[model samples]
Target: MTHTIRRLLTGTALAAILAGPALADETIDITIVNGHPPIFLWVKHLTETFIPTVNAALEGSGYTINWTEAYGGTLAGVGGELDAVEDGLAEIGAIPTVFLPTKVPLQNVTYNTPFGPGEPQVVMEAMDALYAQIPGMAESWHQYDAEYLGGGFALDNYILMTNFPVTSIDDLAGHRIAAPGPAVNWLEGTGAVGVAGNLTTYYNDIQTGVFDGVIVFATAAAPARLHEVAPYVTVTGFGAQSAGALVANQTWLQDQPEAVQEALRAGAAAYQQAYIAEQTQRVAAAMATIAPDEAHLHTLSDAERARWAAALPDVAGTWAAAADGEGLPGTEVLNAYVQILRDAGVPLVRDWSQR
Candidate 1:
């Protein structure tokens, strides 16, 4: 063949190769588990936003994920998701760090330091900053055989729901109120009996007289219909909290291709933003639904909020000391977290780190 003809043939071959698929199409199966059902925004977004976001990110790439979702105690109950994911029962999970305070104490910084900010976005941002600033934040998950992706899912400002009216801190006296995990500490000096409870059992437990009321976030209260059982709604402003994040089994994540890992992380970031946006918008509506009658709703006075904050013991200091005893940087996490909120101009009834 002539030189020109040979060159033309080579160019044609190159064009054909470029026109074909860049890489072989690959499919990966990932199971995502959560204790709560789809009704909860966090779980709902995993299916509606996270999964789709991952798929969208992999569009041009030659990879796709076939997701198996186990929620509402199908594979694990509330507070059991960390174990499920760590044990490799599922490839990924939305683990609520609030429940695993002992296992992942660093992630619970917001919970220990209450009366900060009522906005979920602010709390989420602070947690995200903490994760980046403190090495122990991510190490906490690694030690559990899980990889922490950046969801930073946060609960809205916590409120009080009671069967009876609560005009002030005195009203909580002689009442048995249920709160989840460390939030139970918020009741320390309020004269109320604090019982450990979660959203799954709040309504039934209250209705059955197991507890007279609950410390809960509005986003979940309306859907759980806590209003029917506890008609009085008091905006306590105990502050929004970092509950959990998207996590993956460490081994499972390490075994995946780099592209797959990036996609999952990207999906997590999108899920966080979407979940918080939807949750913030739903807060007011949920409060309205929970307190349809004007007489049933009450916003605690600023003075009363300050009084309640002062009434509690130094829960943050105590928590930090315990974590420090475990050889973690609990004090640094606390101070840094509070500093972040202060820098952001979030009003605080009391500086928790100072105590």
Candidate 2:
């Protein structure tokens, strides 16, 4: 062949090699479900930040996803997320372990041991590390046929929103106070009656006198306008909580292309960062709107906070022991999480692991 012809052939081969990866690209379908609607900050981040981040990362990659978002109880109601993913109704979900205490007892360690760390960033860092370090921690999700991707602590700290001002613990006598999940345990020793309630019905419940007030996070209570009804906001420092997690169907995840799997994992990590950043920023910004008249924010004296924490039963020990009985490293996780808080200089109202 002539030199010119040889050069032409070489150029053609180079062009094909350059086009190979793009030609190999594939599009896959993914269905994401959240029992709760996008109104919640976490779910909002899932749709607004998580999905966009995943899609952006996959751009120009060999795999693209056709996402189907099923939220707002369209596919499953609250507490139905675990089964929805396990049954293959959705490929992934934001499963709130707080709601599935019986099904995923181990993940509730944060809820069980309260008043440790009030910062969401601190709790999130500790929880994320435990999920990686402790044996069988992630396997808790495996039991439900789901893979844990990533999760974060939802609130900065728990507070009280009530119609009546809480001047002292004695003031809670004979009153009904609502809390979500194991949070009711925070109210155990106080004279207040703890009722199981969630944000969706808090307004109605209080309006109908189902409960006199609620213990909730400031970020959430502000947006939901809990201040409108229960104008007295007491900063109880009940500690931040591990509310939910990003999980994918184990079988479906295993069958996915390697790139797709990585994208899902990447998306979850991004979601955690986005969520914590928003929560951290939101606490001050949201509270700015709920000032004196609209709502009164009072911090429970450190002495009072410690007294409340000390008065509660050994919920952490009980929880850990129950987990150990079921063949899990509950004690190890509990210790590690508490130590993480201590190392971060978080003021603990009670050292749960020590008890």
Candidate 3:
């Protein structure tokens, strides 16, 4: 019994010596920022899904992240997230590419080619394909000192919320409407003057007559309470758009350990799935919340959708040409984008690639 006890103690000491002293987890500080508040699906996922996912991934990895979440324009205002991350004001951010059209024009392909797929996941997959196919697609973000982490932050199918009823595209005539970023091109030939605007100002702008209506997504409109101001919800089906992405400061990301980098990338992937799933589930509910009465909602007919698509100037072609002028792979990206949709069997109202 004595020899056995001695052997057991010796084995325990040997194991302890081999293990060495316990090392405390290396704590890394990371701050994530977004312009929109936690109420929005994207931002909500960052807090609920992304950070948690990163933390979960880091488990037992001998590292821990001390996270600081700056949201609701606390760290960066709408359209300023890219600047915030690039300038190192925040280590990471949800950069709305729609707001940075000139800086990241290729990311705006969906906006330029409207009336495509309504499903956000389809649009996101196409974007993923584009990023892989076009080297310049990633290079564009690199120019801003930001590393694009694919979170696939896509907007739901865009709808028009107006104070006036839109029985058809003709009803949009002579009214001023607001569209975000390159989406203004969608208003061409509709006779409605398109003013550049975003979700932050859509409610007040319409209430105060800044514009008659706003081209916005249902998920956002319900939260922004645009329904109270613009009760007429026209389901324009402008198509789900790849609007923004989760990005990190390139310098900061480069400095991170490989495990840390992998954790962040994994977190981004999980965030994308969570955000899309929640956004998709909320879309119908949001539409109902916006227009509770059947009279308040009008889905533009397929014919009207086709007419609207036909009426627009060759926005995709124009955008691509401009990108090519800048020596970026604009035309290539556009063609690849449309082709991906075609291959996926998404019914397109007009093939922007044909133009």
Candidate 4:
């Protein structure tokens, strides 16, 4: 009995010595917010990809996170994501930079130079390369007290969804068309009055005749059932857009352990992969629904597409000039973006960098 008791005590001491410190695990609480609801593919990725990826990455580490997710205006409204993170209302968020162009102007590089590539992955890759090559691009997020993680721009090649059939560019004359973000500029020379609007309100607004049509992607139009309200989907091919990103408060991010920060970045990368895959599939599937005759879908003729592109003012140059006035490397980014796409063999409709 004495020998047994002595052995037990020795084992206990050995265990305590081996433990070194208390090894108390740390738990981090983070709140993620998005202006748009989960129905949007990007928002869905927050729950399905970002959160899960981060959680999985943290496993077996000495730290874990307890996530509190607030989406769809629960925490912030459209164009309010930057403020939410800057004010620490939320530690992290997927900010749609298209809505906050003044704050994240560099992020809108794709928006300024439109009609480049149709594939989201190509644009995403170019943007990623820009973030690495251009210091100012990443610094734009720092200005908002946020750190940018890898993700994508969700907007695919935009089309015009209208109540009236659009057989030609002239068909849009004097019609009040809804356009989200800088896309309103795309209608400048088209003779269409572009009213500012978004996906969430496109249906009701169109139903009530607030706007005759909306400039939107097929994937979004299909899911929102815009076809039910507006049967005409004109494939204008305005361009795919890199419009949003996952950003975390810089103060909060800087305070985290290295492991936690890495996990967050990993989660963001996963989000980019998942988003591109799902968005590609959705676009293809949505195209099937928008048939030639049944859905009143019309792909603008090549000649007409070029005519429309030529009629537009030097919008990309104007955008780059504005950024330069604000002390950003606007022209450099613009030139690099166009060059990257050109090198990748993306057939651009117009040479936006020529101006």
Query: Which residue pairs show backbone clashes in model 4?
Result: none
* lDDT of candidate 2 over 1-355, digit per residue (tens): 6999999999999998987854666888888888766777888988877788888888877788788999878998878888999999999899877888777887888899888688887778888888878868899889889998775436678888899988678789899999988888888888889998888789889988899999888788877888888888888888888888899999999998777778778888889898888888888876666545533767789898888888889999998998889998889999998888888888777889987
Sequence-dependent TM-score of model 2:
0.91
Tens-place lDDT per residue, model 3, 136-245, is 98888887899988786999999998999998889989999999999988999999999999888888889999899999999999989999999998888899999999
Clashing pairs in 2: none
lDDT of 4 by residue, 1-355 (tens): 9999999999999999998868767999999998888888989999999999999999989998889999989999988988999999999989888887777788888877766687888889999999989999888788779888766555788888899999788999999999888878888888999898888899999999898999888877887888888888888777888889998999999999999999999999999999989999888788777544754878888788888888888989998998999999999999999999989998888999997
Local error of candidate 1 at residue 175 (angstroms): 1.0
Q: Please report the candidate that would top TM-score against the real structure.
A: 4
Could you tell me every candidate's TM-score relative to the true structure?
Answer: 0.93, 0.91, 0.93, 0.94
lDDT of residue 263 for candidate 2: 77
Give candidate 2 misplaced runs (Cα > 4 Å).
1-25, 293-295
CA deviation > 4 Å runs, candidate 3 = 1-21
Candidate 4 deviant stretches above 4 angstroms: 2-22, 290-295
Clashing pairs in 1: none
Task: Write the number of the candidate with greater TM-score, choosing between 1 and 2.
Answer: 1
lDDT of each: 0.92, 0.84, 0.92, 0.87
Give the poorly placed runs of model 1, Cα more than 4 Å off.
1-24
Residue-level error in angstroms, candidate 2, position 233: 0.5
